[model samples]
Target: MAHFPVNHPARPLYRVLSGLIGLYILVFGVYGVAETWGDGLFSREDTSALGLRTNLAFSLVSVIFGAFLIIGASRRGNLGHYMNLTAGAVFLVTGILMMSVLQTQVNILNFSMATVIVSLLFGLILLATGLYDKVGTEEHAEEERRRREHPIAEAHR
Candidate 1:
């Protein structure tokens, strides 16, 4: 089983970072929507917003995802942890998939290299935050610390 830190000391910092990323995505989506309003939903035009290429469809999706991240970051329980993990995986997979079709007609999102980079970066950050932001009682934390410190002993049990 995967072991995530419980009661991490830097949980607040991670939360703040994820929140900032969410805010940026939200703002970018709004701007992208305005910039591509008259275009086709999946237009292949070279519309740009916040240094990332986008289309109406992509902008709408971004709005939804950004809101999700914001809500997840605000949660004070394991809900946030699970949400962050899910979001991170989505972002990473999306980035890779988009990058694969960067110059092909399959690029429905009209993703540019910069957009792919940002997606991957956000994914990594969110994944890190999720891994260390688990909430648990002191006893759970102590057990985790002990397990981490004595992996050999733990494996034999």
Candidate 2:
């Protein structure tokens, strides 16, 4: 049998960061569901995170999001880029909404001051991670160097 080489300079960082985010969201959602046993997905009850007031719907969304991120990060595609970008934008908007008076009208995630802060911070991080690949040509040059250096191993394989 033979195996092909997969040279992705950004994959390591992408997997690490996305995996962490996925784990966090998945665990948070699972805990939320556990705390709200019989309640429906769209329940108005608070999440397991005390005083957060975020509902079950948000928890479900979190679970889905986490799963997607894991899948995206595990594969060699543009999933990470899109997922991070989308999540960053959405969370940023959610934070902005939390800070605004419309929070009550769309209290999907129990937009509090702390939530706003955390959301903004995470959003920025994701945004940065998503855009990391495009910042410079250094990564590309490094990848090329690795490829050239390992040509012998690749041929022997």
Best by TM-score: 1
Candidate 1 lDDT (Cα, 0 to 1)? 0.93
Pairs that clash in candidate 2? none
Error of 1 at 78 (Å): 0.6
Candidate 2's displacement at residue 136, Å, is 12
Best by lDDT: 1
Q: Which parts of model 1 are misplaced by more than 4 Å? A: 146-157
User: Any idea what lDDT model 2 has?
Assistant: 0.65
| Cα shift from native, residue 148, model 2 (Å) | 19
The 10-residue segment of model 2 with minimum total lDDT is 2-11
Encode model 1's per-residue lDDT on 64-126: one tens digit a residue: 989999999999999989988999999999999999999999999999999999999999999
TM-score of each: 0.92, 0.67
Evaluated at residue 89, the lDDT of candidate 1 is 94
Please give, for residues 86-155, the per-residue lDDT of candidate 2 as tens digits.
Answer: 8878878877876884346556554557767867886787776666433225565565566679988757
